[model samples]
Target chain A: MTNIKKLISKPLFLPIFCMILVMAVNIIFDAINGNFALNFFTISVRNGILYGRLIDVLNRGSEIAILAIGMTLVVSCSAGTDISVGSVMSLAASFCCMLLAGFGVSSTSSYNVPLFVGVIAGILLAGVCGAFNGALVAFLNVQPMVATLILFSAARAIGLLLCNNLIVYVRVDSFGVFGGHLGILPTPIIIAAVCILVATVLLKKTALGLYVQSVGINRKASRIAGVRSERIIFICYIICGLCAGIAGIIASSRITSADSNNIGLNFELDAILAVALGGNSLGGGKFRLAGSIIGAYTIQAITTTLYALGVSTEQAPVYKAIIVIIIVAIQAPPVKAFFARRQAKKAALKGGVA
Target chain B: MKSLKKINGNTLLLLITIALFVVMYIAGCVVYSTKGFTHLQTFLNILINNAGLLCVTCGMTCVMLTGGIDISVGSLIAMDCMFIAVGIEKWNMNPILLMVLVLVIGAVFGMVQGFCVGYLKIQPFIVTMAGMFFGRGMTAVICTEQVSVSSSELFVKIAQTKIELPFGAYTNNKGVLQVPYVRIPVVIALVVLIIVFLMLKYTKFGRSLYAVGGSEQSAVMMGLDVAKTKLKAYVLSSVLCSIGGICFCLNTMSGSVQQATGLEMDAISSAVIGGTLLTGGVGNVIGSFFGVLINGTISTLVKTNGKLLSSWSNIAVAALLCFFIILQSVFAKIKEKSK
Candidate 1:
C-alpha cells in the first residue's frame, strides 16, 4: 500500500493522470455526440498500420514530442527555456528543402538532389545553429532564453535567405517516406520512439544524465564534483538542435513543402509547456522522460479535442491556455505544500483516533 | 583608477552602444544623403516611429533590472489596444475612461503574474508565457477582426497631431512641399522615458529593485521586501506596457490580435542592446532609449534602400544583438577575472 502510494506521489503520476483525463473526456464527449461511426477511444487497424485519433495523437504529437525530449535535457541542465527551437526547425526545414530542390522553390524542374543530402544537411545546419546558441549559453554564460532569442528572430531570416524567401514544394515522391508509413505504423511515430529510446539509453545507461542533473541543480557544486558542466550544457543544446532538425524534416515532409515563415512556428512554446506538464521543474534538476512524452500527447489530444468540439482555431488556444494554467497552478510549489500539509493533518487525526 | 572603478562595467557597454549607434547613423546618413533622406525631420521621425517601442523597452529594462522578465507585455499591448478599440467602436465609451480601464487591466495582469512569480515561487517565464497566451487568446475572443480606431475623432487627432519643429521643409520629387513634425505620441514616449529614468535613479523602489536583483537573499537579509519589490516591478512593467499600447494605437489608429506579434522580443532585444544585463542588478533606462532608436534606424535604412529584403532588418538587429551580447559576456568575464 505504501509503495503504491509512493508511486502515485511521484511527479510522473500527474501527467499520466492528465493524459487519462483528457482521453476520457474525449471518449465521453464522443459517446454523448453519438459519433459511433468514428470511434474516439479505440485504435483501429487501417491497412497494415493503426488509424484513429489515438494514433493521431501520437503521430501528430511526434514533432513537438521530439522537441520536448531535447527540451527536457536543456531545461533540466540550465533551468532555463529555449525560445529558438521553432526558428531552428525552420532553419533546418529550409535547408532540407534547399538541398533537395537545388535552391529552386518551385518544382518546375525535377529535383536531382539526393534524399540523404537533404536529411544530413538539415540535421547538421541546425546542429551548427544550436552550437552558436550553446557557445553563448555554455561558454559565454549568457542566459539560455536570451541567447536563444538571437536565433529566434534571425533563424527565419537565415531560412529565407537560404531559400530566397520562396516557398519550396517537395517534388520527389521518395521524400514522402518521412511522412508516410513504415510497416505497421506512421514513420514519425517510429522516429519519435527511436528518439525516446536513444535518449533513455544515453541518459540511463551512462553517467551523462547524472552529470546534467547535478549541473542543473547547482553548477558550482557540480563543478566541484568534477562534472564537465559546460560540455553537458553544450551537448544538450546540440541534441535539442538535432531534435528540431528531425522535427523540421517531418514538418516539411508532412506538408510536402517548406514555408520557412510558417513551418514549426510556435513549436518551442509547445515543447516548453509539455516539459512543464510532465512535472519537470523549469528550475532544473531530475526529470521523467516517459512523463514528458505523455505530456506531449496530452497537449496534442487537447488540441484535437477542442477542434472536435467545434472550437474555432483562434478560440482553441484560449481553452488550451486555461487548461494549462490550471495544471501548472496545481503543480506549483505552494499548492503542493498545501496538499502535503492537509495530508499530514489527516494522518495526525487518524493517529489520534487510533 | 578609483574613478574608473566607480564607472562600472555596464557603463562600458553603454559607451559601446552609443558608439555603435553613432557609426550606424553616420552610415545611414551617408546613404541618406544620396537617397534624398538628409532632412532633419528624418532623424526625429525615427524617434517618433519607435515611440511605442521606447515605452515598452523602458518597462522591459526595469523588469530586467529586477532579474525577471515579462514576455506577456507584447500580448498586453495587443489586449490593451483591442480593449480600447472595442470601447470606442462598440460601446460609445469615453476614451479617457478606456485608457484608464486598459491600464488597470494591464496592472492586474502584471499583478497576477507577479503574485505567481514573486510569492508563489513559480517560474517567471512559465507564468508570463501563460499570460502571453491568455492575453493573445483573449484579444481574439473579444474580436477576431481588426478594429479600426481611425473613425474615432480623438484617435485620429491623437495620431495625426504632430509637433512641428522650427526647421525648414523638404520638396519631394513631385515638387510638393512637405512639412515634418514629430507626433504627440513621440513626445509622450520621450516624457515617459525621462520619468522612468528619474523613478529608477531617485526613488526608493528603484534602489530596492536593484538590491533584489543583485542578490535576493541578501536583499531579504537587509530587510527589504523582496516579493513586493518583484511584484511592483511587474506592475510597473505592465502599466508601462499599457502606456506603450496607447502610443502604439495612436500610431496605427487601429487594433488587431496580431498588432504587436513578437513585440516582446523587440523590447527585450532593445533592453539587451541598450546595455541592460539580463542577469539584472546593473542597467540604465537611457541605454534602453538608445536601443529603440537603433532598431528604428535599421528599419529606416532598410526602407530607404528600397530593394533590400525586409528580412535584412531582422538580420541586422540580430547581428547587433549578438555583438552586444558578446560585449556583455566579455564584461562578465572581466568582472569575474578581477574578482
Candidate 2:
C-alpha cells in the first residue's frame, strides 16, 4: 500500500497523470460538442492494424521519442545536454532530400537512389558530425554545451550548402511512403518502438549503461575503475547524432519536403524537457527508459491537445511554454518543500482532530 | 622572455583577438578596395551598426565570467523593444520614461532569475530557458505583428539623427580632407564599455565576480558573498540587455516579435571570439568589444561581396569561434605544462 502511494506520488506520476487528464478533458469535450474532438480510446483493427488518437499520438511522437532516447544516452554518458540535435536533424533531413533528388533542383522526373541508401548515407553523415562534436568534448576537453553550439550554428549552414540553399522537392512515391501507413498504423511509431527496444536492451540489459552512469556520476572514478570514459562519451554523442538523423528522415518523409529552417526546430529543448519529465536527473546518473517513453507520450498529448484546442499552430509554443514552466516549477525544490510542509500540516491537524 | 612567460592566458587571448582583427581588416582592405571599404567611415560603421551587439556581448561576458549563461537575452531584447514601441506609439509615454521603466523591468526580470539560480539553487540554463519562454511568449501576447516606431515623431527624430563623423567627409573645393565620425549609439556603447571595464577592473564587486567564478568554495572561504555577486552579475547582464534592446530600437527604429532572434548566440560567439572563455573566470569586457567588431566586419565583407550567401557569415563566425576555443585550450594546456 505504501509502495502504491509512493508510486502515485513520484515525480514521474504528474506528467503521466497530466497526459491522461488532458486526454480525458478532450474526450469529455468531444462528447459535449463536435468541436475540439479527439477520441481517447477508440482503437479498432483497420486493415489489420491499430487505429486511434492514442496511436496517432504515438506515431507523431516517434520523432521526439527517438531524439529523447539518444538524448538519454548522451546525458547519461556525459552529464551534458546537446542543443545541436535540432540543427543536426536538419542537416540529416537535407541529406535525405538531396540524395533522393539526385539531379538538379528543377524536375521530379530525375532518377534517384533507393530509400535505404539515403537513410544509410544520412545517418553516416550525421554520425560523423556527431563524432566531430564528441571529439571536441571528449578529446579536446571542451564543455559539451559550448562544443555542441558549434554544430548548432554550423549544421544549418552545412545543410544549406548541401542543397545549394534551395528547397529540394523529392517526389519519390516510396520516399513519401516512408512515413505512410503501415497496415493501419503509422510507420514512425513502429520504427520508434524498435529503436526504443534496442536502446533499452543496450542500456538496461548491458554493461554499457552501467559504465555510462558511473562516468556520468564521476568521470575520474569511472576512469579509475578501468572505464574508457572519453570513448564512452564520444560513442554516446555519435549515437545521438545517428538518432537525430533517423528522426530527420522520419520528419522529412512525413512532410514530403525538407525545410531546413523548420525541421527539428527546438526539439533539443523538448527532448531535454521529456528527460526531465521522466524524472531523470539532468545532472546525469541513473535513468529509466520507461519513464522517458511516458514523458514523450505526454509531450505529444500536450501538443495534440493544444492543436485540438484551436490554438494557432505557430503560437503553440506560447501555450507550451506556459505548460512547461508550470511542470518544471512544480518540480522545483522549493515548491516540493512547500508541498511537503503542507502535507505534514494536514496530517498533524487530522491527528489532533482524531 | 620572463615577461612574455608572465603574460596571463586572457591577455594572450586578447592579443590573439587583436591580431585577428588586424589580419581580417587587412584582408578586407585588400580584397574589397573598390567599394571604399578602406575608409575610416567604414571602420566606424562597424561600431555603429553593432552597437546593440556590443552591449549584449558585454552582458554575456559578465554572466559567463560568473559561470552562468542567460540565453534569454535575445528574447528579452525582443520583449524590450516591443514594450518600448507600444509604450511610445500607443500609450504616448515619454521616451525617456519608457527607457528607464524598461531598464528597471529588465533588471527585475534578471533579479528574479538570479535569485532562482543563486538563492534557490536552480540550474542557470533551465531558469533562463524558462525566462526565454516567458520573454518571448509575452512579446507575442503583446502583439504578434511588427510594431513600427516611424509613426512617433520623437522616435523618428532620435533614430534618424546621426552624429556625423568627419570620416565620411570628401575633399571639397578647398581640397581639405576631413576625418570621419560615428553616431549616437556608438558613443553610448563606448561609454558603457569604459564603465564596464572600470567596474570589472577596480571594484571589489567585480573582482569578487571573478573569484566566485574561479572557484565558489574558495570565494566563500575568502568571505565573498557568492550568491550576491552572482545575482549582481545577472542583474547587470539583463540591465545591459535592456539597454542593448534600446540601442537595437535606435538602429532599426522598429520592434517586432521576431526582432533579434538567435542574437544571444551572436553575443556569446562574439565574446568567445574576443577571447572570453565560456567556462568562466577567464575573460574581459574589452575583448568582447573587439569580438563584436570581428563579427560585424565579417558581415560587412559578406555584404560587400554581392555573390556570397548571407549564411556564409555564420560559417565564418563558427570557424573563428572554433579556432579560438582550440587556441584557448592550447594556451591553458601550455600554461599547465609550464607549471
Candidate 3:
C-alpha cells in the first residue's frame, strides 16, 4: 500500500493521470454528442471520421516527436532554449532542395540520387547550424536565446535567399516512396520509432545521459566533478539540429515541396510546448522521453479534435493559446504543490477528527 | 581613460553604426547619381515610413535594460492600430482620445504581463510570449479584418503633411521635396525619446532598473523593489510600443495584422545593434534610435538601387544583428578578463 501511494505521489504520475482523465472526458463527450460510434463485435468501423486524417496526424506528430526528443536533451542542459529549430529545419530543407536542383535532378526526374543527396545534405547543414549555436553558447558563453535568435533570423533569411523565396518541388520517385507507408505504417512513424529507440538507449543505458542530468542539476558541481559541460551542450545542440533536419525532410516530403516561407514555421514552439507539457523543467534536470512523446500526441490530438468539431481556422490560435495556458498552469510548481498540500491537509484533518 | 573604457563597449558599437551609415550614404549617393533613378524619392519615403520602428526599438531598449523582454509589444502595436482605426473611422472620435486609449491599453497589457512575471514569478520569456499571443489574438477578434484610416481627415493630414528644409530642393514632379508641416508623430516620437532618455539617465527608477538588471539578488538585498521596477519598465515599453504603432498607422493610413508582422525582430535587432546587452542592464535609448535609422537606411538604399530585392534588407539586418552580437560577446569577454 505504501509503495502504491508513493508511486501515485510521484510528480509525473499526476500529469499522466490528468492526461488520461482529459482524454476520457473528451471521448465520453464525443460519444454523447453522437460524433463517435464504437462496435464491440469482431470488427469495428467508424462512419464519420476518416482514416486519412488519423494517418495525417500520425505523420505530423512523428516528425515533431523526433525533434522534441532532441530538444529535451538541449533544454536539459543549463544552456537556454533554442527558438531557431524551425529556421534550422527550413535551412536544411532548402539546402537539400538546392543540392538536388544543382545536380540536374529536375522535378520530373525518376532518379534516386536527389532523394539520397537531399537527406544527407539536409542533416549535415542542420548539424553545422547546431554546431554554431553550441559554439556561441558553450565556447563564447553567450546566452542560449540570444545565440539562437541571431541564427534564427540569419538562417531563415539564408534559406529563403537560397530557394529564391519560391517552393522547390522535387519529383523523385524514390523520395515519394520514402514518405510512403509500408502497408499501414507510415515512413515517418518508422523514422520516429528508430529515433526514439536510439534516444532511449543513449539516455537510459549510457553514462552520457546521467552526465546531462547532472550538468542540468548543478553545472558548477558537474564541472567540478570533471564533466565536460561545454562538450555535452555542444553535442545536445547538434542532436537537436539533426532531429530538426530529419523532421524538415519528412514534412517537406509530405507536402511534396519545400516551402521556403512557411516550412517549419514556429516548430520550435511546438517542440518546447511538448517538452514542457511532459512535466519537464525548463530550468533543466530530469527528462522523460515517453512523456514528451505523449505530450506531442496530446497536442496533435487536441488540434485534430478541434478541427473535427468544426472550429474556425481564424479562431485556432486563440484555442491553441488557451490550451497552452492550461497545460502550463497545471505544470506550474506552485499549482501542483498547492494541490498536494491541500490533499495532505485534508488527510491530516480527517485523522485529527478521528 | 577609465570612463572611456567603461563606455568603450557602447562607443565601439556606435562607431561601427556610424561607419555603416557613412558607407550606406556614400553608396546611396553614388547609385542615385549614376542611375538617376526616379525611385530615389521612394527610398526617402521608406526611411520616413519606418520611423515608427525607431520608436518601438527605443522602448525595447528600456525594457531590455531592466533584464526583461516584452514580445507583446508587437501585439500591442496591432491593438493600438486597431483602436486608432476604430476611434477615427468608426466612432468619429478625436485623434488625441484614440492615442490616449491606445496608450492605456498598452499600459494594461504590459501591467498584466509584468504582474505574471514579477509578482507571480513566472518566467519573463513565457509570460511575454503568452502576452504576445493574447494581444495578437484579441486584436484579430476585435477587428475581424484589416481596418484602414483612408477616410479619416486627421490620419490623412498626419500622413501627408511633411516639413521641407531650405537646404533641400523642391520639385512638382515629386510633389514638393519640402513641406511646411513636419509629421506630428515623428515630433511626438522625438519628444518621447528625450523624455525617456532623461528619465533613464537622471531618475531613481532608472538607477534601480540598472541595479536590478545588473544583479537581481543584489538589488533585492539593497532594498530595491525589483518587481515594481521591472513591472514599470514593461508598462513603459508597452506604452511606447502603442505610440509607435499609432505613428506607424498615421504614416501608412492603414491598420492590419500584417502591418507589424516582423517589427518585433527589427526592434530587437535595433536594440542589440545600439549596444544593449542581451543579458541586460546596459543600453541607451538614443543608440536604439540610431539603430532604427540604420535599418531604415538599409531598406532605403536597396529601394533606391532598384536592382536589388527588398528581401536583401532582411539579410542585411540579420548580418548587422550577428555583427553586433559578436562584438558585444567579445566586449563582454574583455570586460570579464579585465575584472
Per-model clash counts, in order, read 0, 8, 2
Q: What C-alpha lDDT, on a 0 to 100 scale, does residue B143 get in candidate 1? A: 90
Q: What lDDT tens digits, residue by residue, belong to model 3 across residues A1-354?
A: 789989876756644764565456556766777765331111322353224544556666887788888888888885367778888888888778777765333353443345677789888999998898888887777777777877777777788777766677777656654456655567888888898999999988888889888888888898999999889888888988899888878777776667767777767767877787777777688777787887776666566666666765444556666656666666566677888899899999999999
Whole-structure CA lDDT of model 2: 0.83
Chain B, per-candidate TM-score: 0.95, 0.94, 0.89
Q: lDDT score, residue B316, model 2?
A: 88
Provide the TM-score of chain A alone for each candidate, in the order shown: 0.92, 0.89, 0.86
Best by DockQ: 1
Model 2 stretches astray by more than 4 angstroms = A1-5, A8-11, A28-38, A43-52, A103-109, A322-354, B89-93, B166-168, B171-181, B337-339
- Consecutive 10-residue window with the lowest summed lDDT within model 3 chain B: B35-44
| Residue range B1-339, candidate 2, lDDT tens digits | 999878777888898888889899999999998787888888988988899989988888999998888888988999999999888888988888989999999999899889877776667777777777678878877778888886677777777777766346775346887567676778778888898999999999889888988898999999998888889989999999998999998888777988887787789889998888877888998899889999999999999998988779888888888888888778777877999
Per-prediction TM-score: 0.95, 0.93, 0.89
Pairs clashing in candidate 1? none
User: What TM-score does chain B of candidate 3 reach?
Assistant: 0.89
* Cα-based lDDT at residue A278, candidate 2: 79
Q: Compared with the true structure, what per-residue lDDT tens digits does model 1 show for residues A63-106?
A: 98999999999999988888899999999988988888877455
Candidate 1 lDDT score at position A274: 90
